[model samples]
Target: MSVCKERAWKTLEELSFIRVAGTQEELKAAQYLKNECEKAGINAEIEEFEIDMPVISKATFEVLEPYKKEYHVIGIGKSGTTDENGIETELVYIENAVDVHLNHVKGKICLLHGRLNPELSEKLIKAGAVGTISIAGSFYDEKSIADELRPRNTFGKGGQLPGLVMHISDAEELVRSHPAKVRMVLLQDAEKKGISHNVVATIEGSDLKDEILTLSAHYDSVPYSKGAWDNATGSITVLEMMHYFAKHQPRRTVKAVWCGSEEIGLVGSRKYCETHKDEMDKTIFNINFDMTGVTLGHEICCVSASNDVMHAIEYLAKLENNALECKLDTYSSDSTSFAGAGVPACTFARLAPMGGAQIHNHYDTMEHLDPDSFMITLNFALHFAKQLVNTTTNLIPRKFDEVITKKLEERKKWFSEEKDEKKKESEENKDEKTKEEEKK
Candidate 1:
C-alpha cells in the first residue's frame, strides 16, 4: 500500500466526526492532529485563540395570515433578537433588496433571496425592516432535507438585525401562494467567548533553515456535515505530507498546520498570522488544501503567488504528467489569510461534479469520497513541495504585483476597520465607567 494513501485514510478516520468551530469536537480533532505528528516522531503544539460563539435560544418562522404554519429555520448568529412573540407584519418577497423593494419594505417582514453581507444588513436596518428570512437549498432538493444555516462573521461586530433561513421549497410556497404576513423569531445570546486551536508541526531543514514553507488545511466542518469530502480529506492529506517530510527532512523548514474555525471566516489562520507576524516575512510560500477526494472531481490550483511561481508550477505539473486547472488568483480558504498578509500562497481543491457530492450539509459523508482521487492530489502536492523546498537555487522570489496587492489590501481594509471600531467602543466604555465612578 502507498504510504500517503494509508496514512491519509488513517487520519481521516480519526477525524471523521462533526468538528464544528469553537466546539469541543474541534479541539478534539486538533489534539488528534497533534497526536498524529507525535506518532511520526515530530513534536507538535496547539495554539489557542478566542472566537465568538453565538448561542441560539430560539429560531423559527411562521406564516400567520395566509396560513398558520411554522418552517424549520436557524437564527443568524450575532444578529440581534426579535420581540418575545416575534415580529408579525406584512411579508414582502423582495427578490433582491433593490431600491424599489427597499422603499416598501419598511415595518414588514422581508424574505430575501440569499444571505446578507455587512453592506446588505446595514441597508436592511436603515430601511426600517423589522426582521428577515433568507432562502437556502434548492427547489430541486427534497423539502425534507433542510440545509443548516449558521451565521458567519460577515456583519463584523455591528450592523445586524434578526434574520433566519428557510429551505427553498418552503420559500417557493411562500412566494407562489403570496403569504400576506409572517412572523420571524430569532433569539440569540449576543455573542460569547469560545476557544479554538491550531495544530502546528514543524520539520527542521538541513540547509536553508531560515526560509520556510507552510502547508495547511482546516479540520473544522460546518453545521450538519461530517465533512469527509469538504475537508476531512484535506486535513488527512496535510497530515500525510507531515509524515513524508518527517521521514525526509527538506533543505528549508516546512510547517504543517491543521486549522480550526475556517468555516467561520478563516478564524484560526487569521489568528496564526496575527500572532506569528514576525515569521511572515521569512515565509516564502504557503500551500493550502481545502476539499478533495471525490470520485468525480477535478483539480483546481488557485494561485496567489507571483507570475514566475505560477509558470514554474505549470511547468512542473507538465513535467510530472499531472493535469490541473491553474489560475493566478486567491481562494476563500486558510490560504487567503496568508496571502492577505503578503505571504505567497495557493489553494488546492478537487471540486466534485455537480450533484455528485454535497457539502456543508448532512450528506457530506465518507461514502462519497474516493481514495484513488485523494492519492492523485496527494502525490501532486508531494512532488511540488519537493521541488520548491529542496531546490539548490532559488527558483522563485516572494513578490506580488499590483493586481494581487490590491486584492490583499481590500481584504485587509475590513480587518483594520473592525479593529478601529473595537478600539473606539472600548474607549467609550471606559468613559462611561468613569462617569459611573463620579456618580458613586
Candidate 2:
C-alpha cells in the first residue's frame, strides 16, 4: 500500500519527451497520463482548453554590410511576422535601453542583451524600433547545442516588436565586429486558438466527498526539452501519490491534474479555475509539484496563504526531518490560478543548483535527474498531502493574507487589461469599417 519510487520513475520515463504546449506532442503526453490513470483503476478525463499556438515557418537572420554571415536563430513565439520579403535595417545593440541608446534605436533593428520583457517591449515601442533580436544561452554553447527561443505570451503584448533569438556567441561576435546593417526574414503560420488538455483523475472520499484536495503538475514542457526534471518528474510524483491514495481511501476528495500549457503561461490551470468556478468553494487546498528530480537540487515550498499555513508546513517539515526551506510567498506555477480564485495553495519544487541542470532546453534530459533525489522529494510531499487531506477536523484555514491577496490581484490585472484591449480593438475596427463605407 506504500508509494513506490521505481514505479514513479518508470512513469516519468514514459512521459519524458518534448511536449510543447498546444502541440500534438502535448496531447500525446496527456493521453499517456490518462491511460496510466485508467490502468490504476481510476477514471480520468481530458478537459480541453484553448491557447494561442504560433507555428514559425521560417526564421533567418544575417548580418550584412559590416560582415556577411548567417547565424542560427528562432522566431519568438506569438511575436508578429514581417512582410512577404523581409526587413533590412540598421542594426544596433541597446544593452540596457538607456536614453542615449533609445534614441539610437529609432527605426533600427536592435539586439537586446536578453529576452524582451514587457517593460523593455514598451520602451522599444516608444523608441520606434523596427524589430528586435535577443541573445540566449551561454557563450560556451556550441552551435550544435544552441537553445532556440520561441515566442512567448509575454512577447505578444500591444507594444511588442517582432523578434528573433540568436546564440550568445554570435551576439558577441556581432557586437565585437560592429555590424551596421542586418537582414531578418521571419515568417510564421497564421496564429489561431489551439486546444490543450488538463488530464484530471479523481479519487472521491468516503467521508468528506464534498471537500476537495487537488494535486497538480504541468506535464507539458518547453521546446527542445525532454523535461525529465522540469516537469515529468513532478507529473509522475503526483501519479505515484494518486496510486497510493487510490489504495488508501482519503477522508476528502483528492484530484490529480496533469496540466498542459503551463510553460506557456499557466493556460491549463486558468481554464480549470474558470470552468470549475462552482467547485471552487468545495476546493479546500491545492498542492502543486513542479521541477524536481535533480541530483543537486534543494526542496523548496512556497505557500501562497496565511502565515499560519506557512508555519504549519515549516513545523511539519521539521517534525519529519525533511530538508525543505518553506516560505510565505507566491511561487510562479499552476498553483497561482487556484490561489487567485481564493483557494489556499502551495507549490513544492526541487530547485536544481546553478549549472547542475538546464531547463527549457535539450539539456533537460533523464540523465540530469537522480531517482533517489526524486524519491526523497516524493516522500516528503506524500506525507504532507496525506496528513492535510485526511485531517480529522479541518484546522487549516483557507483564507489568504494581504501579501498573498496582493500577489493574486497583480497577477489577475493582465486578464482585465487584455479584455479592455480587445474591446477597444473591436470598437476601433468598427469605426474603421464605418469610415470606409462612408468613403465608398
Question: What is the TM-score of each predicted model, taking all chains together?
Answer: 0.95, 0.92
lDDT of each: 0.83, 0.86
lDDT leader: 2
Worst 10 residues of 2 by lDDT: 150-159
lDDT of 1 by residue, 1-440 (tens): 32567667767876888999988888888988898889889889999999888787898888887679888888777767886798888888787878998999889877888876666777888999887777788767764456565455444645357877778788888888887878888777765779999999899899998888999999999878888887999889888888888888899999998888999888899999988899899888999999988888898888897888787787788887878878888788999999987799998899977777888878888887878999888899888998879998756677886778888887777677678878998999999999999999
Model 2, 1-440: lDDT tens digits are 65887788888888999998888999999999999999999889999988877777888988888769998888876666887667999889888988988988888888998778766888898889988988888876656577555446553364357788888888898889987778998787645679999999999998888999999999999878888888998899899999999899999999998899999888899889888899889998999999988988899999998999989998999998987999998888988999988789999999977667878778888997888999878898889888878888876798898988998887777666666767888999999999999999
Model 1: number of clashes?
Answer: 0
Q: Give the distance in Å from residue 188's predicted Cα in candidate 1 to where it truly belongs.
A: 0.9
Clash count, predicted structure 2: 3
Off by over 4 Å in 1: 150-154, 157-159
TM-score for candidate 2 = 0.92
Superposition error at 430 for model 1 (Å): 0.9
